[model samples]
Target: MQSCRNCPCTSRSRARTATARTQRSSRSCVTSTRAGSSYRWTILAAGVVAQASFSAILLGLPAIAPQIRHGYGLTLTQVGVVLAALNVGLFVTLLPWGIVADRIGERAVLATGLTGCAAALVVAGFTSSFGGLVAALAAAGALGGGTQSASGRAVMSWFGPEERGLALGIRQTAVPLGGAIAAGALPALSAHISLRAAFFGLAAGCVAAAAIGTALLRSETTKADEHEDASPPLRNPRVWLLCAAGTFYVTTQISLIGFLVLFLHDDRGVSTAASAGVLAGTQVLGGAARIVVGRWSDRIRARIVPLRQLALALAVAAGASALLVHASLWLLVPALAVAGTLGLSWNGLSFTAAAEAAGRRRSGAAIGLQQTFLSGGGIVAPIAFAAIVHATSWRLGFALAAASPLFGYALLSPLAERRS
Candidate 1:
């Protein structure tokens, strides 16, 4: 107390304390920044795995349509019904799951849904009857629906707006990635072993994906700016328009993914394995296209413009594929590949648009709503395409399905104009 204020030792002590505090603060900041930067990528990886696992089941079943038809002694239309069952289940649950993801977070929802989906697929593998099979597939679809919204929401939360487009695009690749795997593997599994074996393989994928998600997925804490002036997702007109456009887009996707194998095999007389191989190739190309388009949107800083352009390209590609449906394999193969790749590419764009319109706070619900519309189309496209084919011809069904992207293009025009 006696002139300690002027003491050199006291001043030195204060300086050392300040230096130590600054060092600790700097270290903490570096640690936090590194964690934030690195973990988003981990979340992305987990999201991709979760999405791909479920997609293998959703899209894979259609790749082996002939086997499914032969196994169940069903006609083309019945196969459509069987394929639609999964969509029906997804249509019912996607919105609710989205809401749940917003409330409870992505990790719990993805883990629970994927685990349930795996169980349902296991039940599907055991079933021998058509009714039982449809029921099981539907159940799997219902449980698997969470991945659609949860993974998308996770991407939106973890990444900044500038990076979200590309991040989501990478996430969307899981669809084709899963489809490629299923198209290549499920058909072989069904043909070499049995249809049950294929179902079991999909179940194994779901189990692995669920484990990865549960282990790696963590909910990001809600940020204050995320909720400020945010519109309710359901009430947003832009969200609805995006959903409607996505519904139309799904028609093309389902046509390519759900029926490409059948068209190649039955119409072009390509062998099933060869047809599935074409589909697998299409999926690989589509996945690459998604990444490119996503990055393109990020560079251009306009999601809707790129989305509209892709829609027009898809329309043209689908029409070309239809025209070449019965052409020589040399011509038809590349046409179908281009069409299928275009058909599968637009989803990530629409998904990003919807989430952005609703704001991050409501991104889950917006994604859910968008997926619900897509699921509805997925349910109808197969049955309608089959019925059209049954009534007329494969060429006619392809022609009609080609028109869907045109409609999507028209619906997206206003949004693109506004964005520009």
Candidate 2:
């Protein structure tokens, strides 16, 4: 198990290759496989494949929640527990997975985790009890949690800072793209056949993805790669700030993801399907926004003035959108879009900034630590929203969501300043 301390990774020159054209393009034609490297892009492909599969399993469960309920006669809370367990799995492993990614090279961890997730998904398909489902999803979560960050690190290593954001954004879209497939297509499969059958099919997808990922994600040294050098960590402050910013961003994000449908039903007087559709549409739009923001951030990476200003603007818009929920249900869609776009758009830039801020070699750890903050928000957000709703209403809940970005805006200013 070679640590980042011992392992030779992509060089520093790769980190700062931020030319004007390449700044926004994550994978430059001139920079394939780094000088002597072999199959770095293959690792990224593996990550995407694994991520897409995990996306299917993660959302597939919820898509067939009703069928699951009918078959087992379970409670909504029981179904919710399955979903919650996924996070619990992820939360518990966040730190260790990061450490592992840093230790063994991101590829080893990625391949191993994907394989483990496939096994979990296989076992989950056979379980009839709610407890079994929880265990299975939790297993999947723990093994699968690192996929997102590790993939980001892999891509960021290849691309210069200018293009890293857009590159990562394209990669990050897999989350929603996977979810949309599950939401839109898996439902029919689940309903048309059986819940157990759906799980079984998804488990098979995991196996195929695992094989793909293992083949793609690997260390360059094995293939005798050449690359430039970069700085090491002082435990970069910009990394921590990005983590903090992510905390606030996801706190708001998870709150809406978990409860927006409920809010639509109770407050806006929409049917469940309609509400779900609205939320789904918002996610799709937000997914696009992520790509846009990533590319936009890449274009302006050299200019600290615009980066800070744009981040601040996102916060302000999010805050204003949160308040607009009381105005009209139609208004809620755009508000959610603004909130989603702002919250998720940071997917590429924040991580790109971390990679740039700490040098490219340690991007895995930077992204990993930042993910800890993001996962921490997942823990706090739903509970907070539940408390807020219990005390008052989801309206107040969203208002709380709006306020978070203001603080994030403040923290990010210093990073943009430092970059300047």
Candidate 3:
């Protein structure tokens, strides 16, 4: 037995086992080491840039929807289909991207996705026909959905529990900020340089973001960073509740954003540029509200409480805006601003909660699931809102938008009680 232990074959086998153990330990240590505060903020910055790129391109079209319709000689419903196509692409790919993020990490996913978006946007810019435009936008959306889960998982994985709410909140602000940028620039660009130039500009932004993300985004080598757990995200009750609530919440936001400019122009005689400006203001205010509400949740050490409050506030604000649907411009603008703040502010809170409930290993998949439902709402709401306006009136459409948050609030209340 002693001679066998000393044999050359036995020695080689032992060396191989020892080498494997050392490699695993090195990887485990890499993953477990807490990232510095600055590094976490860097992750936030990268995520914001990536998210903003996706939002700017996707939201840019809506800001210039009027120009697209005029150039293509399409009706309102056809315009809605154009907008929905992008989200339809997102809905189709979000889950698969999340699963890939979990397996491959965020760095490759974000860079590749943003780069794909840049390419798709460039193609979209050159397309002459409506069918070509829809196909290109849908392709952009399918690729861009990669950023949603990858960027979200970055914040959730990098920050500790205590600081995640605020971090995620700051991250969430990028959506509205991107929309604000589009509102401020895209419509005017389309007017002056041609719609193609506006699209090229969006593509340029995505290219810049892709470069930044590739340079800065790091893979999580930590077990907490990339390890798979036995439990699937679909099995989490809290995740499902949050997803349902997000569906309703996002429906209201998309409805307002999708139609706000047109509503102001058609109903109040506001110019296209001026109406876009009002929508921009709503987006800016909504972005600020997300930051404030996120910090509020962090201080309270509770997620659902703030979520409940925001949903209620959104419902009330939406109702008030509906009442002002045709009121004085002075009344309507402020009301929509208030509605936007309330309607768009709850996303970070819900996202943070879902991440917590999902645990570190599953954050990517969980966020992906929630986003799928949110994108589903995005896919449906624009067409539905356009139909309602065509059938009954803009008043009915706005009223229905207002009521959406109440249903979100109702779905969330029980979850809050359970968490409490």
- RMSDs, each prediction? 3.9, 9.7, 6.9
Cα TM-score per model: 0.91, 0.77, 0.89
Model 2, span 345-371: residue lDDT tens: 555556566666655566666666766
Local error of candidate 2 at residue 117 (angstroms): 1.6
Q: Give the TM-score of candidate 1.
A: 0.91
**lDDT, model 2:** 0.64
lDDT of each: 0.88, 0.64, 0.85
**Candidate scoring better on TM-score of 1 and 3:** 1
- Ordered list by TM-score, greatest first: 1, 3, 2
Q: Sort the candidates on lDDT, descending order.
A: 1, 3, 2
**Over 4 Å off, model 1:** 1-36, 222-227, 417-420
Compared with the true structure, what per-residue lDDT tens digits does model 3 show for residues 1-420? Answer: 999999999999999999999997876555443443468788899999889889886665778888888988888888888989889989999988888888898988998998998899999999999899999999999998999999999888777766788889989888888888988899988988898988898889888988998888885545554453537789988899899989999998888887888778777888999988888888888889888988998888889878988887888888888888878899989998888777779988888898788877778898889989989999999999998888898888989998898888888877774543
**True-structure lDDT of candidate 1:** 0.88
Candidate 2, TM-score vs. the true structure? 0.77
Q: Give lDDT tens digits, candidate 1, residues 1-420.
A: 868977999989999999999987766543432344689899999999999999998778878999999988999999999999999999999999999998899989999999999999999999999999999999999999999999999888777767777899999999999999999999889878999999999999989998999899887643344445567888888899999999998998898778989888887788999999998999999999999999999898899888888888888888898888768899989988998899989888889999989877788899999999999999999999999999998888888888998888888878884632
Q: In lDDT terms, which candidate is top?
A: 1
